[model samples]
Target chain A: MSGLIKSSLARKVVMALSGLFLVVFLTQHFVINFTSVIAPETFNEWSHFMGYNPLVQFVLQPILIGGVVIHFIMGFVLEIQNKKARGIGYAKYNGGANAPWTSRNMIITGAVVLAFLGLHFYDFWVHEMDYKYVSGLAEDPTRYHEETVEKFAPFWRTVIYVISFVLLSMHLWHGFNSSFQTMGVNNKYSPAIKTITKLFSVIIPLGFIFIALYHHLNPITH
Target chain B: MKLFLKIWRQANANSKGKFTEYTLDGIEGDMSFLEMLDILNEDLIAKSEEPVEFDHDCREGICGMCSLQINGEPHGPDRGVTTCQLHMRRFSDGDTIVIEPFRAKAFPVIKDLIVDRSAFDRIQQAGGYVSVNTSGNTIDANAIPIEKENADNAFNAAACIGCGACVAACKNASAMLFTSAKVSQYALLPQGQVEATDRVMSMVKQMDLEGFGNCTNTGACEVECPKGISLENIARMNREYYAASIKG
Candidate 1:
């Protein structure tokens, strides 16, 4: 296992597997978040269950955090090593001539996504922790709807969320199918997988953007 | 055509390098890029000055001996050709061409436009082979039947010239394409089955030890390869490596 972890190929496999895990988490998170736009009651119930349920709070949430930490740490480690690989810089490297911006600039996109996660955790996770664990607030299933909507009421926050989503879209554009490639998935289904990943990259972020905008524009007036 | 050239110059591996500028006039469109360089060298030798040094052998694209990062692209602006095959017509009159050796931690600049690519040889030495007895006990290669697609792909993977263009073109200087091509060639053949697990594990271990960057799958290597080696070989190697690790 130590030998496996030491190999560059193994390191890449770790990145790919961790990244794919995050993608799965993102899809689930998107599904839950989208409910706030169309079904506030459903959103409140689901959010309440996730907040109070021992399985989610104690088990899955920690695993999710672990995934995020591993992904980012490994990303930084790989990026630094990769930089060292090109010991002397090229006087003029035309990287855009061959590869797409999305493929070549994953580090940039991934960094932005990491920054966005900081803000996201601050806005929601921190608040949830304070509300439930720190203050020891009594369970209120309906409170989730108002709390979520109010967080997006600020125009600046909404704009930041939207911009972050765009960068997240760019990250997924290369990362989604790339994970499959790293897993050594090359077969008859590859073309179909590529198409699906491309579509998902665009659509999921758009859905998140829509949720952010919808809450910002339709804040409760009472 | 007349061209202004910015060529890298260095005395030895331990010495510093810099771009030395030169101008050549009356270059014909039919002259290959290397031929133009030959004329410049002739002029320099006539003046009793040291001519620029670059690597080349066959002058044809077959031998991977030729390597040059011309005008920011490996093997010049033309696609699917080496510097020796790149023609002067690719550039216009008065165009400035920048020539530098392939840059990678694994490929140190030896002198001028020549880089020491013996790192590739070391990686090859690690496990890039099929172990077969030769003392009147070798099985006929034709005895094992391979699928048409697998055979074609193995042949394609075998075409990699070990020219470090994939490393030069990659932003990370990753040698995944070259290594993967080598792995895939043997991985697809029946003779390679016995040692497939060990071959992959050993080669990948050697590749990592060489200090080459990890592959990010940017696909630059595929685009810049003179032979147009496909990215599928990389995916195949990834699969092979993972399976090998699991087997171990």
Candidate 2:
């Protein structure tokens, strides 16, 4: 096990697996968020169940957090290793000659995504925690829709969410197909995978941005 | 044609290196890239200056002995050809060419335009070969019937000449293409079945231990490879490595 973790290929397999895990999490989160516009009661009910369930809060949430931490840390670890591998760079390196901008700037896009995650956690997760553990208003599940609308009501906050989603799109554009390649899934079906990944990368982030915009443009009247 | 050249100059592995500029005129379009360099060296020799040191043996693409990064592209702008095979016609008149040795932490500059690529040799030495019985009762290689596709794939993988261009072209200086080529070559063959698991594990371990970077799937190494080695080999190697880990 130790030997496997130490190998470069094995380490990459870890990154790919963790990345795929995050993608699934993102899809679930996006679907839940999208439900607020289509079916408010169902969205609120699902939110209530997730928030109040001890299994989800204690077991799954912690694992999700661990997954995020692992994915983020692995990105940094790989970036640092890659930088050190090239001791001295070419005086005139035309990286664009061979690779796409998103592929080459994965570390940069990843940093952008990380910063956005910080804002996301502060906006939703921290507020939930404070309401329950700190402020002692834990029993209120009725205000779930109102609270979500209120969060998106601020113009600057909406703008930030939109921009973050755009950056996330860029990050995923390279990441989705890259994870597949890393897992050694290249074959006749790979072109189809790349096409689907490209579509998902664009559409999912666009969906998130649309949800934020919908809430911002039509805040619930009290 | 006249060309301005900026060639990397280093005294040794530990010494500092920088690009030294030279001007060459009356270069013909028919001259190979290495031949142009030969003319420059001959001129330097007449002036009693040390000729720029670079590696080349066959002056053909087969040996993979010739290694140089010409104008930010490994083996020059043209694809699928080594430096020795690249012609002067690839560049227009008055073009400035930057020549440098393959740069990587694992491939330290030994001198002008020359890097010590024995790191590749070490990785190969780790587990690149199948341990075959040389006793009198050895089975004939032809008897073990391999599928046509696997046999072709093995032959393709075996085409790699251990040139360090893949390392030079990779943004992370990853040697995945080179290492994978070796791994896939043996892994696809029947003789290599006995040690497939151990070979993949040890080769990848040695690759990481040698200070090479991780593969990011940018596909630069495959694009820059002189032999046009496919990115599929890297995928195959990854699959083999994952299988080895799962079994253990």
Candidate 3:
């Protein structure tokens, strides 16, 4: 049992499973955020539920955080192990010959995504946490849309959000189908899976970028 | 043709290694890559210097013994051929070739271009064989009717010569292609069913214990393998391993 987790393939399995979980979470997060553009009232209601629901706050949020932490930690661990496996660096390595640039530079893209998450936590989650725990303020059930718009109203913050979504798209471009392949899902339907992953990679981030742009360009009127 | 060569020179596993340059002339375009090295070795012997030691046998590319990293490739610049099979016509006159040993923490340099590839032997010994009894009571070959595709895939997996090119080609020094080939060959055939679970588990465990890196699906192993092993075998191995884990 211990051997299963310690093996290299098993480590990859952990990475793939955790990555898939995060991808699902991203989809749900995107849907909720997208609601802000079409139906602000529904978006606020759902946001209040996610923010204050005991099950979501106490249970799902911790699991989501754990997934992010494990994915990041395992990625770095594998990268270090890979680096150490090649004690002597090659004088000339043609990495582009067999792999995409995104695949080869996963650690770089992943690190940038992690940095963006830090900003994301600071902007929204930290405020929510302080409001609930430290300030002990009564929850305003209607400020969800206003808060989101205010966060993106800053030009620098909007720019950062836009750039982070682009980087996230690049990361997903490789990571989406790669996680499936690692889980041994490569078969006759793999090409279809790859196509869907490509589309998802682009569309989801584009949706996020659109939300950010909409919020930034047209801030909510008081 | 005249050629300039920069080759790695290492004394032993623990010793520091560096590249030493040499020049040779009157080389024919039809000569093989190994033959070019042979000519240089003869010159070194005549000069009373220690001739560079490299591994080769059955120079026809079957032995899997000839290993060299030429111009940053496992079997030189040419695809689909071992170093012993690479002809000199691939290069032009006055060209300089850089050669080095296949580098990996699991494959330590013995001397010059030769590495200790006994790690592969150990991984194979872990579970790369069937446990059939040989007391003349074996079932007839025709008794088991396998699909043509299964037979072909098994044969393809069986074609792996344990050359370690897959390891040399991977940026992370992963042996996934080689290990998967072994696992797939057995998993695809009925005779390998009895110990399939144990075989996949033990072999994978041993492979990890050997200090090899993980596969990131780079696909360089397939591109660089002389035998043209496919990465599909890796997916198959993963499936087998997952099934085994669930059964356990």
Name the best candidate (by lDDT): 1
Question: What pairs collide in candidate 2?
Answer: none
lDDT of 2: 0.90
Write down the TM-score of every candidate.
0.98, 0.96, 0.95
Q: Is the docking of candidate 2 incorrect, acceptable, medium or high quality?
A: medium
Q: Which digits, one per residue and each the tens of the lDDT, describe model 2 over residues A125-194?
A: 9999998899987486677888898999999999999998888898888888889888988899899989
Fraction of true interface contacts that also occur in model 1: 0.76
lDDT score of residue A163 within candidate 1: 97
lDDT of 3 by residue, B1-248 (tens): 99999999998888999999999999999999999999999999999988999999999988899998888888887888999999999999999999999989999999999999999999899999998878899878669999999999999999988889899889889999999999999999999999999999989988988888989877788999999999889999999988887777
> What TM-score does chain A of each model score against the native chain A?
0.98, 0.97, 0.98
Question: Best by DockQ, which number?
Answer: 1
Query: Is model 3 an incorrect, acceptable, medium or high docking prediction?
Result: medium
With a 3 Å backbone cut-off (N, CA, C), the pairs that clash in candidate 3 are none
Better of 1 and 2 by lDDT: 1
Deviation from native of the Cα of residue A213 in model 2, angstroms: 1.9
Question: TM-score of model 3 relative to the true fold?
Answer: 0.95
- Candidate 1 lDDT over A1-222, as tens digits, reads 555767888888889999999999999999999999889999999999999899999999999999999999999999999999999998978898899999999999999999999999999999999988899988899999899999999999999999999999999988999899888887898899889988999999999999999999998999
Model 2 stretches with alpha carbons more than 4 Å out: B133-139
lDDT of 2 by residue, B94-207 (tens): 999999888899998888888889989998999999887778878888899999999999999999999988999999999999999999999999899898998888888889
